[model samples]
Target: MHDKYASVVKILHSEASDLMSLAILSGRDPFRFYNGADLTSLDLTNQNLTGLNFDGADLRFAHLEGASFDKGSLNRSVLDAAQLHLKDGFEFNYQDVLQFPGKEILMFCMIRSSLIDEILIDFGINYSVFAEFSKISTGALRKARVGKVIAIETAQLIFNGVFRFSKTLDSKIGMKCINSIEQPCAKMLVGGNNKPFVEISAEDVHRLFEIRRRRIAHMKRERGTNASPYVDYRDTAEYLMFYKHLVDDIDFWTKFDEESA
Candidate 1:
């Protein structure tokens, strides 16, 4: 019986190692190998079966005491009359988050509570300027601040606004800055095909004005302009991009917690 159990375990590992690894990393299914396998009355005692996928497998009257497995190894597997021992400390199920009935609202709230302010502060932008530039309605912004769920269309508008504003800023700065230099040139980059002059767009002046507002806000807190992160001339001249989005909120948040820990 012991020899038979070892052979079965070896064969399963050989066939499904990659899939099991993927499932563990992604919090997804890894049961392709044992989707419908029968291992009735088998002795798997004291075995190390961590991260294995045993979905749809039969384990009736199997001796599984002291066998080690990850939180999700036996998901969807049958365990009628089987001796089992499950360890603790398996909290925060990604599946539960996915199955949540109010997940959409939760996502919207998260964005409104954190992402909007984060983007604005990172860009040194004021609420009014951001609203005007992003074309986000004042009402919608107010609703978002109070934790009210905004429409999907409004959320999309905010995202597009961030993307477009970043791109426009990049274009303006790129035309002004010289190669390998942080500051913009004195003259605009246009006209004769000689040495390129920096093209200071109207947007540049507006950004500088916004930076001044940011500096003023900092000064009110007794931090002063010197304490501001965006006080340098390069701050207005430099271009930054925002190119990423949250595709899997659960996965993203989980990774965030792990890294912070």
Candidate 2:
């Protein structure tokens, strides 16, 4: 199977824009076939690319709009300015709560749990890779994994590490559109007049991260030598909501540049 996929990749590389190579991958797991392939500027428009694994693929400027990739993995793939179909809306719920213990320790547990690791997995990347890009350090990442109450700076570091670092060209363009334009872009609009709902800049995310850190510190201090700190549910809820929106905003913006173009 591996050899077959390797052969397919060789063919794909030779015929960079060949639909026949893609047709050969129809109804099959295209992960191995396209992984690490130089698919730059490929015209994948309206293709059924469901569940394709594009890890390490250089898809810069690829046309991906109208394509379906509901289960595809673009992990660590370069998609500079690649057009993609954006999601209609964002969804968040308790199911996304990572693990148990409920809202009180949601944020901490999210950090402690496999959240970042899971994200890295989707990106076909590892903690060390994220550390190198995020500059948060492996030790600090480990501490975060252990659910330690990280400092405010570290919190911002983690946020930047996940979202800001290693951004594709489209991500940068989308963010610029959001920041520069006063009019509502994409689904980021609100009311009938299409006013901007919110502008969650890197600074805004950092502020939320700081607020979350301060709340954790305050809760720990209040506990005061008794035992473990009780994470406040309300505080966690507040930050988590913003965190969800921030994620949605990023996702939307990544696809937003194409619409503006």
Candidate 3:
């Protein structure tokens, strides 16, 4: 573990300058620093990140297999490509108790797919159909919309789900899936309201499915190696089940089609 820590520290220190701008050094004392930094693509495998408050940090592509975060705070941290595993008979808690502060929040609790789908339809902010799933010439579309750009909040939700369950899938496939979801979501928010109605490309949609594939791979691995049954990340499954909710929100805003001032 010491060796692992050394490697992680070296990488962080060397690249600290570049990352400092992206790092969130908030609060004070035990929970008073670095709440939501972006530490993506760093190798922190098998190190002890226990009790660290990474409450909204982007830890995508970080190697954390067998790492100890037993009591660490990752409330809203992004773990898209991170690897996690339990140590000798140790049980890891995967509960998402972190409160993400925002208005356009997207919550996905574990439940049946049908129920999730219904909930998404009820809360979505856009009216655009998931073009990838249905034909462009489908029946009449719904007119409900939310008229606000909530992509950032929604993206974080998606990232959290990918990170929490990434370790279960094949590394390559998992990374691809995470990138698929994270990229467009990030892009949508870059210009904010200026590009509110930006369409997600076909490539991006494919990436979402890739996430599903990787999830299945992870489930199979857990069942075959650990004797545990296949369990998908309830959060992610729920989000996908009710993704249309976000679509509704976007569509509503587009109906007005007023440019951002």
User: What is candidate 3's lDDT per residue for 60-129, written digit by digit as tens?
Assistant: 7876666665232443466663233221111111222123222322222211113213323333322233
lDDT of 3 at 212: 48
TM-score of decoy 3: 0.25
lDDT of each: 0.43, 0.46, 0.37
Highest TM-score, which number?
A: 2
- Residues 1-261 of candidate 2 have per-residue lDDT tens digits of 576577566655664444435646443544346667898877888887653445567888887777765322453366674333232121211122222233332222113344455546545667888788878788888776554444434544665555554354355443332221111111111111232123233233344555556656664777765524345443433344333433434654443333323
Q: How much is the lDDT of residue 229 in candidate 2?
A: 37
Give the clash count for model 1: 6
Q: What lDDT tens digits, residue by residue, belong to model 1 across residues 1-261?
A: 576466455545554433344344433333345456687877777766653556567766767778775443454467773334332211112222223223111112112244455456555777788778768887786565453555434544555566556555555432221110111101111111232222333233333345445544554567655555543323211221010121223443343334333
Which candidate number would show the highest lDDT if scored against the true structure?
A: 2
Candidate 1, superposed: residue stretches over 4 Å from native: 1-32, 82-96, 99-261
Give, for candidate 3, the lowest lDDT window spanning 10 residues: 88-97
What's the best-to-worst order under lDDT? 2, 1, 3
Quote the lDDT for 253 in model 1.
31
Question: Root-mean-square deviation of each candidate, in angstroms?
Answer: 24.3, 17.9, 20.6
Clashes in each model (backbone N, CA, C under 3 Å)? 6, 1, 16
- C-alpha TM-score for every candidate: 0.26, 0.32, 0.25
